[model samples]
Target: MSNISAAIPPVRWGILATGKIAALFAADLALVEDAELAAVGSRSIESARRFADTHSSGARAYGSYAELAADPDVDVVYVATPHGRHVEDVMTCFEAGKAVLCEKALTLNADDGSTLIEEARHRGVFFAEAMWMRCNPNIRKIQDMVAAGSCGTVGQVRAELGFVAKPDIARLWDPELGASSLLDVGIYPLTFTNLILGEPTHIVAAGIKSDRGIDVSGGATLTYTSGAVASIAWTQMAWSDNRAAVSGDGGRIEIAPRFHETTGFSHARNWELDEFAEPVLGRGYAHEIIEVNECLRAGRTESALLPLDGTLEIMRQIDEIRLQIG
Candidate 1:
């Protein structure tokens, strides 16, 4: 716990894009005290200036990622580009001696993730895949309960996350965008399942690919060594129930819409609700920033809430599911 409590340097963050998710994260980061939006860089200077004006406190803005990464004031960079662009974006930051917090699916596959991790280690800089959901305080509480046998031996878990996504888009449906239910939406359930039940020994999956040859919907079942099973489903072509449930011998845990959002959660047993109603501030994304700040202050590279190894293992499972389905 000493390392956990050690003083972390205030991290100067360089944001790498002005996309929707980037805006969301920037807004959330603004709510945290120790994080600084020191700079923003985009392919277009116009976009960079616009984002900086709107989202930050007049931080340095650059027209290119190279310039942003080269900024001496920037201690870390948030790689908020699209899935396919993740590799190039993060690599640029690492090459510039900047630590990085890359978005989910890390890099389209396990191999790319390994490369990035190794590169970060070799450079002696912090590197983390921004699987922010795992850092939510409520999710961590739920994990604690499950691990403490509060739910007894796990029997089965079911979770799903999906939203209606247009078919004609360049991002969600375009095969070149690395678009797929398996990568975009499926990663949520896969991450949640791994957080609760650990890695599965085997996985069986079926995918529904759109006319554009991208997976728009999918379902997967994982069988674990402890005989616990997790079944997950994801879709982008249409909206789903958008709920998550973890069932065990003693009780069940249910997370509501946008389970990753940390709005609230419930626990029940024997047909009676035992616990309910815990709320958090500011969209719930800020906690990950807080965790990152705490780690940086403590001089740690990886977060306890979202460990590097756990991220790689979850990515490997995603790869396996893709291989099994297609």
Candidate 2:
């Protein structure tokens, strides 16, 4: 690592949109040194002030997103808006010449993601898709193990995430808001597949659509050029095993339930089983936060691990999957 890769000095953070994810991010940010919750913006001033007061003391609160974007004190901004508004929100950050860490599925489609990348590059601003899983130490270790041939030729992989979400939730049922479980939850498993199998050569998708013309539950099969296969599934209407497993002729590995978050994993080789789990550090978001801080400190515009190319390819896969299902 270069000397410039040190953690950022006194990084000031501004949050756009005050919601559950925003609150969680603020709480996690507090656990990292040299990082400050400088401001938060919401559609309502009162709401912004409430979030600031509860999550960050003495932090500026703006009633509108544009004001927060224009805050000169903020070194970087985290765009936490709904999926439908990500493009506009991220563009606002870029317009204000602020580095951005936007929430994932970075944009509604692959083309939009490319647009964000183009603008960020044109302006020479730091940008990253908040694919937190890619930044986790445990996930990196797993990737290393797979590359070392621990799983032996890796013939197949499978991942599932699901919960019994009620239909009353607006974002869960509203088609206009990008309410597909495939986009909201399935991205995790799909990303996992991409990490393990690279990009798939062919994809087959089918799912259950809601009355609002949204996919509430879905499953997909991905076949790679190496002849490896991955099966992925997500649902907002039921409970599932929520485990991910990879198998090969030599051995197998199983990530514990709720694999999206860095928990633990089980590995078996030659009928011998072992378990591995990394120590916790601030609900697992701290790692990604640290990665961003290091990138900014090094004056880098994009992360090598979470590059835009991978994000765009995943999006293309998403588009293809949705097309097949529809």
Candidate 3:
């Protein structure tokens, strides 16, 4: 737990779900001084209690999400359920008058996201998609440099993110669970491209379907209005040499591990590799926690780093790709 920023008033947090992603987020939150692990909720009582004890001693463990959300000690909730369950779980928090930071693939589709967003707006509560990579300091630095025209007149950006999937894993293979390589893994590369280029005017995609009828591997080409293009690839059938590069008239920039982890970028003109490392509290996930704290402090419900509009646009593209492949 590195103290990258001074601890502000601690934001009491209720963690919903007792899954791998939930555990990762809870561990990360424990590293942030301004983030309090107030409660953990799971459908199973034993799992909820175990998760709480493992990450935060004396933190409340609720047998149900409702119990966690209604806990007066909790100021906000983090939803870490699977993609298909996002809308129901997130809406449970919002309906209970709790602010939410839900994990990405915000919902199964755009309509569900719009419904959640509208609910949050009507309730006057904060709602955010946990697009953690967008808040990573190194990623932000790249965005800043690009916006500053450091990479001048961006030409083409290419990014790929993939890892071989365990064939028997239900979440990765189940179609009824809204599983797809495009949503689960493709989103990372798609998002990486969109982050730098904004909404694409044209998107072309192709993919091989899984035994369960989900995308197992795929590629996409997104063309921006500025005539810039980004090509991205994702796969669940095999591991990829995941990396990202953006080329411009003036120079090119490289992103190591492109999707997650500590990112380092280099500009081709200088021909020198420079690493921009930011202090990450726990396993580098505290950056998003800090972002949430800053937004809450500023009385803002949405974040500019992972803005609502950007989320919607990206989801629309994902939906389009799924349709095209289907």
Candidate 4:
């Protein structure tokens, strides 16, 4: 824990998976003033116990997700399973009456995303896909500026993300597991364009599929109703610039490479450029953790900043892109 955010009462959290992402989130949750890592769950009781001991003292350890979800002390559950198991894992939490903030690319496909959101709505529980970028303060500032026409008449956008996947990374290259560069890394750039430009009127995409048939690299062009267009690309074979930009008639906003977790962006207007940086709380994960806490505290089932509708729309677009690439 670094410095605690003031006045937010503790919200006990149960993590429903013992994975790398689970550990990262558990550490960040400690930085939140209102967050308590109350429980951890894994297929093996010993695994859960080990994770809890490392992340949260006194946190209960459950041998199964069902037990974790049923833990009465837990206020919410964070699903950190791989994409293939998202639906089943999320259902466990939802049906258990626990609020949830599941890791993103919320599900393997659009229908699943819709199904999850519908269930959440029906359950009247606080639910959110952990698309943490939407909660970054500087990203929010750029969004505000773009909406206010700071980047006048935004005409075009571009974003790219790429990284090499080790052969041992089972989830990155396994077709049966819904492995694809688009879902794993491309979602960030796709969501970036979608946030700034809204839904696309026309979407054109292409992919370089691997021997196993999952996309290893790809690109997309999205044209919006306002004539604004976006170009995005991703690859799992090698690292690229990983940069994003939004250009308008007046100027452009340049997001630093690896923009998804970036601290700031540069904007130029009327031939002058200015840089803005808003250092996020705790590796940029605390913002979303706080957002979830706030939503639960306010008795809200949905977040206006990261709405379910948007997640579904992106999943739909992803479906279309994958089909085109195939």
For all predicted structures, in order, the TM-scores are: 0.94, 0.96, 0.95, 0.96
The model with the greatest lDDT is: 4
State the TM-score for model 4: 0.96
Backbone clash pairs for candidate 4 read: none
Best candidate, TM-score: 4
Question: Worst ten-residue run, lDDT, model 2?
Answer: 1-10
Q: How well does model 3 score by local distance difference test?
A: 0.84
Number of clashing residue pairs in every model?
A: 4, 0, 0, 0
| Candidate 3 to truth, TM | 0.95
| CA lDDT, every model vs. true structure | 0.84, 0.88, 0.84, 0.91
lDDT (tens digit, per residue) of candidate 4 on 1-326: 54446675589999999988888888889998778899999999999999999998789999999999999899999999888889999999988899999988899899999999999999899999999999989889889999999888999999999999999988888877779899999999999999899999999999899999999999999998899989999999989899999999989999997899898889988768899998788778789999999898899999987799999999999999999999
Candidate 2 residue-wise lDDT, 75-133, digit = tens: 99999887778999999999999999998889888999999999999999999998888
Residue-level error in angstroms, candidate 4, position 95:
1.3
Residue 192, candidate 4: C-alpha displacement in angstroms: 0.4
CA-only RMSD, every prediction: 3.4, 3.0, 2.1, 1.7
lDDT of 3 by residue, 1-326 (tens): 33435545588889999889888888888778777888999999999999999998779999998899889889889998889888888888887889899988898889888888888888888888888888877778888888888778998999998898887778888977778888887888888888799889999999999666889999989898999999999998878888888888877778777445544566666565555565555666678888888888788988887688788888899989988888
Candidate 3 stretches with Cα past 4 Å from truth are 1-8, 270-273
- Model 2: colliding residue pairs: none
What does the lDDT read for residue 200 in candidate 2?
Answer: 89
